[model samples]
Target chain A: MTQKYYAQIYVTLRPSVLDPAGVAVRSGVQQMGYDNVEQVRIGKYIEVTLNANSEDEAKTQLDRICDLLLANPVIETYRFDLTTVSSEVQTS
Target chain B: MTQKYYAQIYVTLRPSVLDPAGVAVRSGVQQMGYDNVEQVRIGKYIEVTLNANSEDEAKTQLDRICDLLLANPVIETYRFDLTTVSSEVQTS
Candidate 1:
């Protein structure tokens, strides 16, 4: 049976890098009626669902993937979380 | 009074767009012991905190910003959410 795993990865730039996208979002939020908003930062969120034998193995594989391809070690940093669901779980 | 807003924007490639990153992540998860993993998709997550006068205004501004700069409408699509907190709320 195939077990399902959900992973969320967040990627962001180091503080030193310029964040034009973040600034634009900040300004947009302010215009949207949140005048109190002060600062804004932007990043990437990646979600994946995969089949795994066990939670531990899935995490280990995901780590390697992040290091090798998903994340660019030279410029961006990333953090991820993995969750497992039994194949028996109902999917609507 | 300044209001605080937290916005989360998720950006992803259209289904037609090839997702090499997503494929890499899926393979990585499988390698880690998640043999059951089947498919994976990758996208961007953007978080921003900004100051605005009212909730409505902030949302409008944020929309403009997203259209003008934060998102690349040509290739990527994005969705966002906004939350407001009173300035009096404690920040640790």
Candidate 2:
């Protein structure tokens, strides 16, 4: 039987990597008077919906997808959460 | 006493809004030969480290930061997870 899955994937730069975007955001927040804000690192949050035969099958597919398309392994790292969803929801 | 807090924020476009980036990603995934992928939506994931007296204070500050700098209320929505971190960790 086919099962539906929804995944929330987080892709982040390795800590050793310099993040110019994060630096810009930190300055912006400091300008807003939120001086307590110390640091900000920005990354990608991707939501994916898909179908598979089993949880393992879904996970394997997702990992491959992340490696191939969603993340660049050189300077970034990625993690994801998968949950089952009702198949009734249309795939749009 | 001051405490250290780490926040993981997710900022995504509202469902009704058009997501050209998502569209592009979905097509790319499909081209990668992942036919089972139904939909793909991309958004921002941010990691923030700050100092607050309490969890409530941290949440309040984070909400304001997200509203004013991280997310656009008109077409985007955001949510976050906040966790306490050891004060010994230096904020770099």
Best candidate according to TM-score: 2
- Steric collisions counted per model: 43, 0
Residues A41-64 of candidate 2: C-alpha lDDT, one tens digit per residue: 999999999999999999999999
Q: Whole-model Cα lDDT per candidate?
A: 0.74, 0.94
For model 1 chain B, the run of ten residues with the poorest summed lDDT: B28-37
RMSD of each: 4.8, 2.5
Docking class of predicted structure 1? acceptable
- Model 1 off-target regions past 4 Å? A16-40, A72-75, A83-92, B20-37, B72-75, B85-92
Misplaced by over 4 Å in model 2 are: A88-92, B88-92
Give every collision pair in model 2: none
lDDT per residue for candidate 1 within A1-92, as digits (tens), equals 54678887888887777788767766766666545557777777888776666788778777776777677777788888888765567767
TM-score for the B chain of model 2 = 0.92
lDDT of 1 by residue, B1-92 (tens): 65777777777887788889878767776666555557778787877676677788778876776777666788778788888766668777
